[model samples]
Target: MAEKFLQAERYEAHRPHVRAVAYRMLGSLTEADDALQEAWLRASTTDIAEVRNIGGWLTTIVSRVCLNLLRARQARREDDIDGVPQTQGAATVVDPAAEAEMADEVGVALLVVMETLGPAERLTFVLHDLFAVSFDDIAVMLEKTPAAARQLASRARRRVRGTPPPTGHVRQSRKREVVDAFLAATRAGDFEALVALLHPDVVLTADPAVIPSPEPVVILGAHTVAKGAMAAIERAAATGVALLDGECGLLMAQGRGLRLILRFAVQEESGLITEVEVLAERETLAGVEVTAL
Candidate 1:
């Protein structure tokens, strides 16, 4: 009874820190909670005498559980499509006091950007860069060599730091502008305007199956994307529906219910938009807020 009490006490004390770590790793509050619950269940079944450092052991268990979840996610992504490549960038250094000010604005935006990173790279970078966990410790959690963990952290650092040119606050504002313009163009059927906004090397990719493309089409360059957009708009119009606010708003038919709400991402360089990523996944769009037009 005494030993059980002691173990429970230790687990309670360390739960908050473990939760923080899991939340940062998974990027979803719900997932973190679930992971913590599973970790605790595993810990409860283990022999108390065999474990030396209870805190460390609990943390490792939590991390391993999160890692397994991440692996499953990666496998699903691979089977669905050729997996998205991991990012290589430097970590953003935000001042403690300034973090609050940036919470809703920059903080949320940064979290969204972090979604682009692969699970392992994100875990390594968050542990090493954000939470100050040693690479050796992270390597243990990941079951990888320290040298490999460090390499993943370095790549993540570069990707985070390498803003699409311009950098800092100015870059963020410009990105918002590009998104707004793209949304406007798609709604108004302004192909020329949309083409003008895109960089010559612009690349547009929509989620497979969700967007209902005849095949996975990768449109290169502003002109090409503009043509594709026009075709898409025409098809949508034929169905007696128009996209609200270009691509950022919900899709509603003349007499039918709301079909889907599309979320867009615009990556820019040197003030020119280079990449337009449209996510039409119903599951992904669940939490997104779209304005009614």
Candidate 2:
């Protein structure tokens, strides 16, 4: 009885911290409350003897629950696409005002951006970046290798740092050569080569669908964007250089299913990329038809 009392006290002390983790993992206050409640129940039932650091243990428990909820939500959305009737509250409509408030309160446009991330990407980013949780610990929760977990976080980071929309194409013929050289640099992980292709003050932006944060990740300057993209060598292997919406760029895919599009705004006279927008929202990704390379 005494031990149980101590455990309850400890759990209460950490409730706020636990709830904060849940709120970031899920944008909804109602959902965060639900996740915290579930975490409490699991913590209560867990063996007290096994937990050395109560706060860490509780955080792990709450994160795992949030991860499950995010995955289930994605699954439910997928099911709805197949005409399957979802459970009540499965497709719950978040009040637009409330959603806006949450986003503002968090000082991020995370509310809208979170919907764009895959489940694991969301969890990995939230736990590792926002909460300062270790990747090894995250890997255990995610059932992934630490390297794989790190890769997921890297992908999420790139998604957040979105590409700018391409506009004003001139000398479209030379676009392919520039893009091809860019990909070759990316594949080779050659930093100088990549930087040479970008305009001195280039801008990059991405849609919320690829980034879970409220504000889109935007990068400015040739050198900065180049160094960042150089690390994308592994992803380069999976990318196909092609033309999107009449501009030359890259098409990323998962097997035959197109998953992302990178549209470049080139400065024809200089033969440098002025803007690079990598978009992966469902509508944009789905309607993409590759132009002849």
Candidate 3:
């Protein structure tokens, strides 16, 4: 009874920190809270009488819980490709405002790039890079050698940083300028400016997942696409310019997931965006390579 009481007290004392770790790992506040509860339940039954570093032990427990949760989430996403409904965690209602708030606090750019990483890579990077947890300790949780754990984190870091811009018909510098301007105008909700950056007859094509229509959406005319861009300002705030399949484009992310990729076709002479291809289908997105510009 005494041991249980002491463990509970310690767990409560470290709840905030543990919750932070879980949030970073899971990216969803609700899921992080769930992972924390699960961690506490496991900690409650563990023999902690001989534990020396109570905080480290508790963090490890929480990390393992979060890691398992990430893996399960990943598996569910894979199943979704086969049209399987994700019943688990569906009943738990999540507040969109809260999730958005949390995503802002966690750095949207990092979360966006991290979404492309594997579960182990995400866990390793979150534990080691964000929290400064030693690779040796993380290796134990991942069942990998310290070097292997380090490698995973390194790979994640590369994805996050992405590669340099590729040589193309349009000047790389001009491509960067256009993408930067487009993102700035979109986030600022400057419709005219956005339209000015686009060709007069610009075509915007989006996968069905983006517009939820029976078929993929094809919006013609610069003004029409600009209007659509206005409605997505909030998402624009979380978007970043990236090299998509050797072309400069924008990556749109929500929470820790890559929601869409916007690839633009720049008119070499005018530097205006002639085409905007919005890729959101899981299969299509998997084939699109993203690198840093």
Q: Pick the candidate with the highest lDDT.
A: 3
What overall lDDT goes with each candidate model?
Answer: 0.61, 0.73, 0.80
lDDT of 3 by residue, 1-293 (tens): 88778888988999988888888887777788888888888888888878898889989999999888878888888878766646555434568776765676666656666777888999898888888999999999999999999999999889877766545545877888998999889877787899999999999888888778898888999999888666544566557776677677788666566778888888988999998887788888768777644
Q: Taking the tens digit of each residue's C-alpha lDDT, what string does model 1 give over 62-95?
A: 8888888778766766776644444313333434
- Candidates' RMSD to native: 13.6, 13.9, 4.3
Candidate 2 vs candidate 3: which has greater lDDT?
Answer: 3
Off by over 4 Å in 3: 1-17, 42-57, 74-85, 90-92, 104-118, 158-162, 166-174, 207-220, 232-234, 254-257, 267-271
Give the alpha carbon lDDT tens digit for every residue of 71-180 in model 2.
99888888787755455354334454554345444533233344578889988988888889899999999999999999998887666544433654446667878888
TM-score of 2: 0.52
TM-scores for all candidates: the values are 0.50, 0.52, 0.74
Question: Which pairs clash (backbone N, Cα, C closer than 3 Å) in model 3?
Answer: 162-292, 163-292
The segments of candidate 2 whose C-alpha lies over 4 angstroms from its true place after superposition are 82-101, 163-293
Which lDDT value does model 3 have at 220? 94
Residue 19's lDDT in candidate 2: 80
Order the candidate numbers by lDDT, best to worst: 3, 2, 1
lDDT of 1: 0.61
